[model samples]
Target: MNPDNREWERVDEKMILVMRLTGAGKSYFIQQLTGMNVSAGHELKVHILYLANFVAGTEKCQVIQTSIGNTDFAIMDTPGFDGTTRSDAEILKVITEQLSIIRLGYNLKGIVYLHRITDNRMGGSAMRSLDIFEKLVGEDALSNVVLATTMWGNVVDIAAANRRDSELREEYWGSMRRRGSTATRFDGTRESARAIVEQLLGKKAVVLKVQEELVDREMSLNQTAAGVLLELEVYAEAEQIRKRLEQLESELKYEKDSNKRLEVKRSQRRNAKAFSQCAEDKKTMKSKPGVEVKGKLKKWAESGGKIGLQALQGLAAIVSISFGIAGFILGAGF
Candidate 1:
């Protein structure tokens, strides 16, 4: 305190300040960034310093700190300051106290303004929070405010999602271009955490190896396993496409065959109707007496001639049977 009067090192110091609103996972984000277990009791020197008592013994603010790699950063978890609830006012007081403490005791680098990805509709709460941030940090602190969208793991499509992420960023800092506090999106997951960490460190993309976290066992059967996963996926997709195409072809063939059958039935019906009409016309012409009698004789022969000659033979047989019975009775009497 006597020798070095400066609170912070220099402008190019590797110190960072992470500030996010409530429920934005400020504590969890800091833990992930530093790869430290900042749980209830997880062997870490991280502690939450209540800033409320610093200003007034009644109110206090909470700040989370962790050392990421070689750099030491301060992560600030601010409470809701919308002044809508009694607890909110207390939290707002704590936030102001913490800001005062930072300005007086510590050197501020940049601020990460945490906003929920789901909270797309920016109402009065967000506006009031921004206003408080602006008033407490001043116009110069605008460059330090990093508009960070937290809970980004909930977003399915970062590019296609209908989230009001850009609107809020632009609306809040559209005029503060001089400060040049760039806005960035981050996913709240291990993969996203790694990516964000690399981006902050200005490093290249590093592939994280897949690690089995569950129970491990020694394999008794030593065999090399082939990766057919991609092949299986391709085969399944191709089979589905083939089945769909076959169904379409079968439907088209059925339609064509039905149409052909319908045409054949229509043609048959037309031919039968024409033949019936011609027969009717021939009957009409034959009804006149001037028509040839040869046609009637031909029809009688076509009836097999039994209709006329067979009836006559039956009458003759009945008469012969009656005579034979009478002759037999007379002979017996004589």
Candidate 2:
């Protein structure tokens, strides 16, 4: 048999990942593609406190092997750690470790990002997850990413779905598409699911950026692209929040009315939450690997250098908010 045409069994399977937020049709999409019921897998990685300390093993990633047409695939389903059960830190750790193990054995093909077609709009948490995903995979490997949206059967408005798809292509998914990522839709049927796999069937399998960073470069969690970008965002947001807090404190000093001071105090408390989270973010990055960490984050996180954070955040807001607003304007009802 030709090496290229060989249908490797479980041990030598061509693997791809199917990633999405917790309920964004990841399970249904996989079943449609693989002809297997894989719902029983993907338990959360449990951490136990023993003797007043905590420990955990890598347990979040699940792989199932199935053949469709002439090719054999090991589909890796991820519980996209969107801070529901596990923190992003834990999620990143688990995914990197699992992929490292798989990299030694299988030909990791590409990433299948399953998004829901009926999302009303891309919610904030979903957007953040996608942002982290891009940082994990990097711009160089985007050609290996398939932005495959599912749950089309639930979407009643055909034109609306198309608009949403276009909106994603133009706005949310635009940069990835420009970098060679392909976007497609998956209806619920088995035929449709197989078709999704067919699209990536011929693409050459490649090592993901996460695998390269963690395995090849032997970089620590903070030194990795995803980790650095995450810390940068937290630091930037913290700096912004700190400015707001200072202004509020200054105003409180000048304000005379008791009611107004109380209002300022409430606002300060709310802003303090962001401060506490930022402090925790810094602490986690420093302490997780059991080393004293030091280094400034890169000036610009994207492929290019030094795009202002304000400009990036503004553009993201415009793109994200427009998805919901465009539905109404285009007569694509929610």
Top-scoring candidate (lDDT): 2
Best by TM-score: 2
Per-model root-mean-square deviation over C-alphas: 48.8, 14.5
How many residue pairs clash in each candidate at the backbone level? Answer: 4, 0
TM-score of each: 0.44, 0.64
lDDT of 2 by residue, 69-188 (tens): 456565666657664554566566556654654443457778888888888798898888888899878877799888988888888998999889898888999999999999887778
How many pairs of residues collide in model 1? 4
At residue 245, what lDDT does model 1 achieve?
A: 49
lDDT of 2: 0.62
- Tell me the whole-model lDDT of each prediction, alpha carbons only: 0.40, 0.62
Please write out the lDDT profile of model 1 over residues 105-194, one tens digit for every residue. Answer: 334555566677777577666765665555444454455555677776787777644447767567765665445555667666545553
* Model 1 error, position 279 (Å): 99
lDDT of model 2, residue 159: 95
Error of 2 at 221 (Å): 1.8
Off by over 4 Å in 1: 1-18, 36-60, 82-89, 156-163, 190-334
